[model samples]
Target: MADDKSKRDFRDRDRVSADEDYEVEYFAAKAGVTPQQVKELIAKHGNQRETLEREAKALRGNG
Candidate 1:
């Protein structure tokens, strides 16, 4: 069975910007997902730093 957390669309790729640098594990923790998932999202999306910020905001209930 898959983790219920993994089933959720927690990572917001649209909020990511292209000119920022973010740590993989940090982003994953912020996004409530796995680091590998964060990496995949970064690869599929464009901006990583922006995404990380967005994920952080989401985690903080600010996004």
Candidate 2:
């Protein structure tokens, strides 16, 4: 069977994709941080969703 590249299974919803602009933007907006900040967070803390969220909140003085 051919792979469906257009389909998003959301299997990795619990993690953020640093390479995907949409995922970074969504996370940034939700975390009250800029997209650039989200990228930096991904770099500094890795792509784990909870870690990024906690760090982003800290950046925004919310955590």
Candidate 3:
């Protein structure tokens, strides 16, 4: 159980690192949502930067 938890934590850390260039926090704030919510959306909808940006824009009422 501990090993599984550790692996999940490592994967989460890696995902955050992979998204480091995306300014997720800034966009999430602009979209009036939590960073984890934006991350989940990105993971669900495909991890494409353009797609995330469009989603963020729409959430922020800019799109």
* Cα lDDT, all candidates: 0.54, 0.85, 0.58
lDDT of 3 by residue, 1-63 (tens): 122433454334322322553556755775676788688767776656556667667666743
What alpha-carbon RMSD in Å does predicted model 3 have with respect to the real structure?
A: 7.7
Q: Assess every candidate by TM-score.
A: 0.42, 0.80, 0.44
Say which candidate scores most in TM-score.
2
RMSD of 2: 4.1
Residue by residue across 1-63, what tens digits does model 1's lDDT show? 323434657574445422233545655666676666565565665545665555545545732
lDDT of 2 by residue, 23-48 (tens): 88989888888999999999999999
Q: Candidate 3 lDDT (Cα, whole model)?
A: 0.58
All candidates in order of TM-score, best leading? 2, 3, 1
Better of 1 and 2 by lDDT: 2
Q: What is the lDDT of residue 43 in candidate 2?
A: 90
Evaluated at residue 41, the lDDT of candidate 3 is 67
